[model samples]
Target: MTETLADFRRRVADFLAHHGCPAGAAPSRSRRPADHVAAARVHQRALADAGLAGITWPVEVGGLGLGPEYRQAFAEESAGFETFSAVFTIGLGMCGPVLLALGTADQRSRYLPPLLRADEVWCQLFSEPGAGSDLAGLTTTAVPDDDGGWRIRGQKVWTTYAHHSDRALLLARTDPGKAKHRGITMFVLDMTAPGVTVRPLRQATGDAEFNEVFLDDVRVGPDDVVGAVDEGWRAATLMLMNERVALADNPIGSPVTLDAVVALANRTGRTTDPVVRKAVADAYVAQQQAELFARRIAGEVRVGRDPGALASIGKLAAGRLATQVSALALEVAGPDAVAWDPADPDGGLWAYGELYAPSLSIAGGTEQIQRTVLGERVLGLPREPQADRDVPFRELRRG
Candidate 1:
């Protein structure tokens, strides 16, 4: 007999309790980056062992092969518990889906199982110094080697969790003779390769969660290519759309809750302040709107409907809400948001949230890019004028 949703929820709840944390418990935010990675792997392994991970993916790729309703049920049941799956966000959210959609059968058989179990962490290596917003203009080059493989030489910046990742999904120019977006190819790169270097970029939060990766004559077998050569733009676009959808939940796991901020306002004696009260109310409403928008998109996708560019709407809304909520938290905390006692980890969390808030608007495509996508694709607006739209990558002038 098929299991009911209530039974599935109870099973998940029992697993979560036995695994590490119980429901309504907060995630440990003060752990070091490496510690977080270790905990994520352990928790993800437990979920995989319990058959709770990859709820909607194919069973052939180490998933449960269940419908999207099961996935949604799992999300609802696990809402309050701390799963520590954020470390695997890029792998499961973006890379794994792209591989399933455009990868070879062998590639899926080799990569997806370890990914589902967190046996190997993955990151995205698409952004470069010159191509943050204009990803298609990336100058990274991957040339065919004499050994029927490829040699990649380029740099990627703003790579999340790269230092802890075992693999990465890379985009590089395979044919500079073609137009900027035409000659690209996607590859699965081993992060521990001989010519790969990862340097962490310290954020204002005093953490090195992001990195700059340098590749020099990195060798990749022909089988590592994700999709057709000189046609990576299509694969990249799909990955990006998936990324925006993933960002709707704020996968970084630091959600700014209204209750927590309200408690802060009461503690700081700002509850009576009209200005602060109004701002808090506005932030709360925005948060609810963002959540509803995300749920709407998720509902459409769950039923096998294509949200298309509508995915960008949720991402844009959530990013802005993050910034607004964090700023309001700062107002509520007053001076405490800027300077907190070093011994108290919880005291510094809101401060950290404020610092991390700006990145939400920047990552997974910038706010401006999201607007442009919505404008052109969803609103049927005219395309932005680009003089070099048809120019070959090599012919375009570089700064």
Candidate 2:
């Protein structure tokens, strides 16, 4: 018999409580990739044991075989507590979905179960130094070998959690002669392989949450390929759409930050200051709007409908909202928001958020690209002018 939402929630809550998961504390952040992965693995194991992880995944793949509403409810409730699920966001939110959609039956059987249980963590290996916005212009190459495997050589930057990941979903060009988007293929790479190396990247906040990966002659078997060889562009597009949706739909987990800002205003007696009040109110409104927009898109996706251009709307909205809220946070905090001290009692969390806000606009896709997409696809505007539409990538001038 299927369990109701209420019963599921109660069971999850009880399981968490019984397992000594703390309640009502600030979410944990780790600078060490090993610590982050260890914590995430533990949490995922607990959730899987209790049938809470991968609630919407197929039961044969170590999931509960539930619907998206259940998944949404579980996420919402899980947001109420402090957890390390965010550490595995790329795996659970993006890679897993892509695998489910594009993976072969053997691939799914070999990968999905462990992923659902967090036995192996995954990272996205898509964006390159030259291919952030024009991802199709990526230079990563994969060549077929006599041994029935492919040799890959590439560099992927801004790869989140790569330093800790067990695997990567990699994109590379298999046929340079084909159109930019038509020559690509996606493969699941083992990060522990001898040809793979990951270097941590230090952010402004002094945390190495991101990494740069180098793939030097990394070999992958034919079974590692996801979807059709040349059809990977479509699969990648699907993964990216899901990524934008997930990012936009991320639940606000820092209510304490919001409360802290409000309390600071009240304590400083600046609640009546027109500028301060307006800033605070505006931040709140943006958050609410982002939440609503994300919820609507998620609901549509849950019902088996493609969100299409509305996914771009959500990504654009999230980028704007994150920037706005970070600015508001800094404005409210005044001088304290300049430099963060880890040892400081408040831990300078607001300052960190402020520093990290700019990445949101660039990470999944650039704000400019998203705007062009929305305008052309959603608003029925003319497509952006491209002078090199018919030119070969090799002949195109490097700007």
Which pairs of residues collide in model 1? none
RMSD of 1: 2.1
Report, for all candidates in order, the number of backbone clashes. 0, 0
Candidate 1 whole-model C-alpha lDDT, 0 to 1:
0.83
lDDT of each: 0.83, 0.78
The residue-by-residue lDDT of candidate 1 on 197-281, one tens digit each, is 9999987768788899999999999999989998999999889777755554334534566678888888778888899989988
Query: In candidate 1, where is summed lDDT lowest over 10 consecutive residues?
Result: 22-31
Point out where model 2 deviates above 4 Å: 20-27, 30-33, 83-85, 251-257, 339-343, 388-392
- Tens digits of per-residue lDDT for model 2, 255-335: 234566788778767788899888888888877887788888877776656788777777777677777777777787787
Strongest candidate by TM-score? 1
Residue 292 miss distance in model 2 (angstroms): 2.6
Cα-lDDT of candidate 2: 0.78
